[model samples]
Target chain A: METKNDGPKQEQRLTKKGKETRARIVAAAAKLMFERGVAGTTVEDVQREAKVSASQLYHYFQEKRELVHAVILFQTAQVLSAQEPLLSHLDSIDALWSWRDAIVSLQVERQCRGGCPIGSLASELADSEPVARAELASGFMKWELAIRGGLIAMHERGQLRGDAEPERLALALLTALQGGLLLTQVHRETSPLEVVLDAMLAHIGSFAQS
Target chain B: METKNDGPKQEQRLTKKGKETRARIVAAAAKLMFERGVAGTTVEDVQREAKVSASQLYHYFQEKRELVHAVILFQTAQVLSAQEPLLSHLDSIDALWSWRDAIVSLQVERQCRGGCPIGSLASELADSEPVARAELASGFMKWELAIRGGLIAMHERGQLRGDAEPERLALALLTALQGGLLLTQVHRETSPLEVVLDAMLAHIGSFAQS
Candidate 1:
């Protein structure tokens, strides 16, 4: 139920070219943070990777914390957008399985390298960075809502049992995905992701109308 | 499937007093790393926290990577030992629910503040540190096996359907747990963890013997 109201708001004032420069910095920072984590990725490193001078980087982000906020927004948008229409219409068991397949395939493609971008941020900042934690929380809320949309549609169509709670079910699916990705990333294998998603989808199937 | 053969091996040669000093250093390092993350916690912080001189700290650990490996082992042992007999005896639905309750209660007691100790380390180190990743993967494998022990016992007793694979089920439970804890930590609530565990347990119950 946590809402996302606060994000890096400097973009509204930037010209088109300025926006591009800012976004390029965020992209580089995201990639580095995803690989090395927040504490390991420094402002100087972001500057080096983004090919921007100290003045240019500081013009957009006053500190690494601000840059981190931008990265959270960037990664959240990327992850949610990647799911696209599939996440919006999880109305059937088959549709859910398709979503599962898409997730597993992506992890397999990456050879289980980086864990969930938002999740990695959450793990690193949840204890120390209150602002980052809120932003990440909002990102998860948005994701949970996207997932809930599908289950809500299924429930409305009477494809699911009366006891099936769409909100809870959607949250469970997202939770499984996070855990699966973490395990898969550590094990450098796809089975953890595959197994957890399959288990969640199977749980959903158990609620199907018969 | 990962094995835990490699841990900080310096303890084997230490006398009782040496072992205590080494353990004190690891405990301090684990506490700092748990709060500030692996990259954020430096050797100086650990030495200061443990009240040890630099020479003494160097005598025990050659570098921070060795210290991290020690922290991983310490956390893994702490987590598994805390689970105790419950993790060893998750043979029935009621027993599983009890285990779930214990986990939730601990999270709530902590006010949902530090995410799983092992999970936080895995998130920060899994990608950057291969040795630490293997240590974490081994920890998860051991935890999975403990959960599997109960499920396998139930399966052999015909308490579950023939189709139920204990290994997969145990992995699912642990996966759900990691995801739920991550969400709960970010949102500072207990529902995500509660819902995921309940869903997974319900899924397990669906395989109950008629």
Candidate 2:
């Protein structure tokens, strides 16, 4: 059932050089898309940036859509890995505060230039590109699940109330985070994110088992 | 103050025909941008879609960036005017619930296709396009102000506690709304938005003067 268009699947069977070239192309595309948006980045631009020949680029991604899909997954991993240390320590409120601080500080350090990388991709592709849309949704789900797991751990430790719904609360926290990033991304300031995280954390604090 | 490159200021002095043509171009651009995004859209596509001659297009918007700015304003107005009626009734907690219902209903009606039109634009242009970024930020500010004004009204009526901090609460509410819309847009479901709004409203209810 393999067709000529099954370039992506066959790409997985590449040699180490081919795999490295593929990864390099994806990394270049991700950086370009982050700066210029999915619509702005072109296959030619990726080829030039990644220093891959057009044939080599096509060997990895048969189409631009396929490349974008790979970029979404790449960004999802990049965003999550950066937060892994904080994510693993979220059993305590102090850990949550630390996590929030890390996020804000990262924004500040980047001069609030780029919002959440995964969020930017999601916003651009969600409506127009169906495949990328699903992948982005899955990315958000993974992010929310990570946050929810931490909340559930806190509930198990009796830090949160018995009635606190971990799933809903985690969704809310993730939403606040996205909203804050959207505002901060536009304003090029950390105030919106700070205000959002603080308010959301206060709401979470209210549910503590006193 | 009359510079040669003052394309926008001169546009304000248009005749009836000129105004209509300008509006037509903006509306067409907005529609295309909504579907294809700013990067994917071009002057040629807009000219064809708007049915304006090349000279006419340049007469209105000297460049694509100028057209994008107009589209941003168009979307801002489109988003705000739809909620104007509900926004005016935020004097009571019931009004807030009604507003929330209206938003959810609107999303359901659209099958959760587009997130906030303004939000989508913000995510794409915030970093790459400075003027558009500022315009998008202003749009969010206007939206936040409307919400903050409502909360302030409630606080003034003693419906909310004296320490409710309407500004922060409004920002938080706005954040939650944006986050919910982002998730909903990608998932093509109303549940993410529904859950976020409900949880945010519950938090607001906690500040009610009982």
True contacts kept of each: 0.88, 0.73
What does candidate 1's lDDT look like per residue over A3-105, in tens digits? 2333344687889999999999999999999989989999999999999999999999998988898899899999999887788888889999988999888
The window of 10 residues in a row where model 1 chain B has the poorest summed lDDT is B1-10
Residue lDDT tens for model 2, B150-175: 99999999999998888888888888
lDDT of 2 at A50: 99
CAPRI-wise, candidate 1 is high
Q: Model 2: per-residue lDDT, tens digit, A1-210?
A: 112224356666999898888889999999999999988888999999999899989877889988887888789889999997997667778888999999999999999988888888888988888878888888888899899989999998889999888788888888889988988888889888888788778778888884
**Candidate 1 lDDT, tens digit per residue, B30-63?**
9999999988999999999999999999998889
User: Which candidate should be chosen as best, given DockQ against the real structure?
Assistant: 1
